[model samples]
Target: MAIIECSKMDKAINSLLSRQNYLVTQANDLARSFGNLTAFEHKVLDYCFSFVKAEDTSKQIYVVQMLDIIRHLGLNKSGKNYQRVAEAFQALNTKTALYLRTYKNGKNGIIMTSLFDYIEIIEDGKIEFQFSQKVAPYVFELKQNFYSFKLSELSNVRSKYALTLLKLWNANSMGKLNKATIKGTLEEWESWFLGSDNEGKPKRWSAGRFKQRVLSVSIDELGKLYPKNLFELTVEKSGRKVVGYRLDIIQPKLHCQIRHT
Candidate 1:
């Protein structure tokens, strides 16, 4: 338990979050619940990451002023409409549950848990919490591949799919499948959604069903989040049958080039 002052919290906005200075989250393609976090929820989570320190394990508990957050989110600075804000944090407290991959007894396993180790609302305009200790190694000491981006870029995204794509995309914004273009059989996608959650109730989804339910809807949202062509998706087909997807991504500088061309 430690006290993070207001100065540290202000750095999320008041300081520079260059492309090099970004939030690094553990990569879990099969992540659900938290993966499905709504846009507002993702915004708040990015705000929280502004105060997290990868080097300091003792720096757990974070004090966030809701008023600053409100202004940052373009909400009325003087309004008493705390309910909306309350519900958003309540979702953070309740719905950010996830299942972390772990190994025990030389076997694969999952440890079901929530993002925050614990959360408490101190006042109508503030809240505090500790990140789970087990995730520190994955989030902070990221040595291998992990998803990351300037936290400032994610603040205005209004689509959950956009946020999910951001997580699935690499630092360069490439949509990769094991390191190259994504091309998998339509049948392979079913287990992904089914295994998305750990509740044991698997959801059956066909390629056509998934397109209508998820893919087709996510296109524009990505444009709003990325400059342009920072990420793009194309379909792969086995003759007439839709097999998988191929995502094309480019550097931030190339965004303007693609747009102009």
Candidate 2:
């Protein structure tokens, strides 16, 4: 057997150690953002967490019941007004409803304050929302690394990519996914713009024809390909007319080998 190399092993070990340190730092930052909580705040957060996690029936019934109990409980007995408790309930309802609406609306559903409330409730009594300073850095990092990708760049690609990304983001955030279910949505879009004979039976348009029309209207329009680029087109038959063609990207791969002595 050949002698082992210490230098390579040492470099690999150092790289792994650095990665571990980074993860620890990230976790500590998140924990700090949660911060210490007051006893009353702890109870409220616990109720919120339980309210969200319970079964559908439990959540539906207990959410209102718990709020009423908290409002009238001895903790707030000193103040008969129960203004804060009322405010918390209203805020919770509004935030939850708004989150549902946003989820329904797709990418447009993101709201900063609602997101804060969500984080607050999920953390329970362990972390206070006041110490959110530590969380902002991580949020900013996430935005930079992931959310910052331009939607406009995506819009130019086939709608399929845009629709797929929207579905993925929704599934990751809300545990539910909604995709455009209307069959031939993309095909219909293509026919509206590039179909050769509007009245005649819809003919399956080639990718080259689609690209040509796109370039003719505006060279800057999205999904335009070079004249020389190789593309494959498939047309589907419809009862009355040809539906439309699908365009795909293809690139040639080259392989090379080297012999070392």
Candidate 3:
């Protein structure tokens, strides 16, 4: 017979964590800076934020079970899985997104913030981490611009571009968005997903090239993600040459559901 011992740190982490279903994250005018995360890295970051200790100002260690991560990522429990998870953190660790907050004077905006602090792999296939206090409010606090969806639902999204599209769509309030959706020029679409610099210049992706490379491919891949009716990806055309795109809300399964008894 064997007895399992739980350290005080483990106990503290367990006590701190809440079994929340949805992985909530936000991107307001102050926190919209992005460095372009891959599919795996993006989802893993969201999973960690799901357990962020909103009440703790000081660094709080939250334990995440490897099994849950593996299951969420659709990977079998194995050494390779462990390696992949570690790699995801390694990638996210170095990947920094700036948080820009305006001040009273608003003297030519330039205040940068780090999103993640550190990560540690622990015993029993569990991991620990701490996020910046500046990020806690936007993540856990309520905001008109908040974006949240199920942690499990995003596991199947493999296309980085499509997932990015979803994030940008949710970042905005879902009204003027319809106009943005309807008038989806490729230049605007690229800026939203890839983002722009302080001077307001985005990485180049011409409409024709983007259509041939990312646009059509991302739409198809997104269709394959869970909650089948994720979004109605419409490619607006002008006599065979792809002109623009329109992403219609199809009541994604993660966001909208009807209960049947």
Candidate 4:
């Protein structure tokens, strides 16, 4: 059995190696047929075109060397006959011409555009590029539609948590307890018990205080109000007697309600 498994593994390895070699051979054949070109050919062509009309002696020599190599490999013949090579050269020429024209119009504009693409600002304010004018309307429509659906989904989700919170709040309510009622309701409860100055907003609830409040509420009340399987309770700060209860165990959702006094 071990020998059979080993042989099977070897066969799989050989199959993969054969496929890879076949792909490499096909790629080389394709390259040779297309003006005897490789990926670097396009890059070299770009560099040559940058000085297509230059009087600079060194640039002239570089362009001459590139053209000579193309002629030596009969690439001109391939480019003339092959559709792919013709199309590639056409694209290269178009882009090179546009780049030269743009550069001539304003070298500073090219430099600024390149800098804008590379640098990101993150202080004080936010700025971003406008979408292409042609696509802007459609892009905004799609974005608005997505956000509308997302907000609806979020509202539906929040309603579930809201209902659970309301039930928990009502379950064990005492007329006027000085402590927090529901763990999440600490700020509201504090304001009701203490005063407006004490409980400002939900953001005031620290993680430790939030955890303590959630645990203070009975597990039975939590289970009755919210899905029982969605929560778990465990002792935190083991040396201390305090136990922490987590709502939405798999993906806990704790919503705090704050009321201003």
Candidate 5:
């Protein structure tokens, strides 16, 4: 077996992630921005994202039936399921906050906003919603650029960390690329997984705890989703201090490449 040097791997991973910035754009930003959403809320958000079209603008209102969402989750049409779906939407309306970075007038700034302008769930029938104008651009970009799977493909995913990692993978991977790598500072890794606190700050975790709770758990589930793919995690450290992480994924050539229209 060949031994790989940590410094060399870190350089290569950083280079790849850096080059991807132009292509990934707002989609990757959105992937790393939000924090408080639950697994079910993430699914509901993906379901909403599927409605975005290449030609649609931020002002477009999307109407989807609650029954369709239930069916998409592979559940029978029952009162309990309907209530659960409705509650999920309510959580989505409240929890889908986005924090984005901006540069203007030679100064750096941040944009704090919610993902949706408003959401209305009718009596077990249909839901009407609109993505916030501030976030709609990212949603549109996510659909056209980073959304690799339909809502159906994610129906069985039960972990928010796994789902978030899948979005991150799609954000970083260019179309049909055989291998993809995700590199982030340890703090970023925690933000992508645990999100932020009620104070709108990323939650803190030790490197060991983060790897065990976030990285390992996500990889285990994704392994089930893509049995043929290989995922390798490398820890970045400075002397005795942990700094960041890199996840290298080697995917089959003909893996799931479905994109939502």
Candidate 6:
């Protein structure tokens, strides 16, 4: 692993992020969870996460004006944009589902739940919601130790693939780790990016198609985002067939600090 000092631009970004009000935090489990959200929906989800205070609980009903999300994304306030923000929340309600394995009383089972307990979009533009009880502990623990990034840093990431990659990178870095490597099988990579199908299976794509569409596009955008950093993707092969991927991100030693509010 190679270490580079933070560049001028990197320092500026860190400074700006330090002043921003929205820092999205997630436990590695939630970061690696399966979700099929659009780019705008992802932004909305992050915006909601930003409002979570250290003292907040899953049962706490948080409220935010829908326009606040639009403004935070640096979008012009328009009827169309408002509706877009509203619809994104609606999509998040169904699309951000999580299925986790659980064990209790010597029995093993699966827990199926969405990120939000419920989302109420009032006609007056106020949006109220709460995290599911099952997912609350993870969110709450993130304040102590978790991967976090500012929405300000990710506001320009237009591709869903790129956004997901950014989040995964932050998660895998484990806080101040300057160089992080993410290893996953082809199926796991697909589930992380393209998400599951109607039958609850990862969408199958030829290796060529998956690389061309998801990996290359995402890596290209991420390279632009962190020009001073290195984003390398190596394909793992079994004979002539692709089996998995190893992605390594090397950057400067600037500690990604998460502020507690």
By lDDT rank, best first, the candidates go 5, 6, 3, 1, 2, 4
Off by over 4 Å in 1: 1-33, 78-81, 141-148, 170-206, 224-230, 237-243, 252-261
In angstroms, give how far residue 114 of model 3 lies from its true place.
1.8
True lDDT of residue 254, candidate 3: 54
Q: Residue-wise lDDT of candidate 2 within 1-261, one digit each (tens)?
A: 122554565565555433221121232122111112222332343344333321232112222343344443435443442545544544433322111112343322222222233332221212223212323343333333333223333333343222332222322222222111112333443433332232333334554564445322332222142232223334445674555444332232432121111
**Alpha-carbon shift of residue 143 in model 1 (angstroms):** 12
lDDT of each: 0.54, 0.31, 0.56, 0.29, 0.75, 0.74
- Candidate 6 backbone collisions, by pair: none
Worst 10 residues of 6 by lDDT: 17-26
Name the better of 3 and 6 by TM-score: 6
Distance from true location, Cα of 8 in model 5, Å = 40
Error in Å for residue 26 of model 1:
5.0
- Candidate 1 per-residue C-alpha lDDT over 182-215 given as tens digits, one digit per residue, 9 for 90 to 100: 3344543333322333443334577677766655
2 or 3, which is superior by lDDT? 3
Q: Write the per-residue lDDT of candidate 5 for residues 32-78, one digit (tens) a residue.
A: 65556788878877888888889998899999999988888888989
* Maximum-lDDT candidate: 5
Give the residue spans of candidate 3 off by over 4 A: 1-35, 52-60, 105-108, 141-145, 173-188, 191-202, 223-261
Per-model TM against the reference: 0.66, 0.20, 0.62, 0.17, 0.81, 0.82
- Model 6 agreement with the true structure over 58-105: per-residue lDDT tens digits: 688899998888889888999999999988988888777765556569
Q: How much RMSD separates candidate 2 from the native structure?
A: 23.4
Candidate 1 global lDDT: 0.54
- Candidate 4 lDDT by residue in tens digits, 1-261: 987986786676555433221111111111111112223333333233232222332112221333433443345635443444334344433322111011234321111111011111223222122222222232233322211122222223222223233323322232111111333233333222222221222133453664445333433343443452233344333344333322223223454222111
**Model 3 CA lDDT for position 33:** 40
| Model 1, C-alpha of 15: deviation from truth (Å) | 46
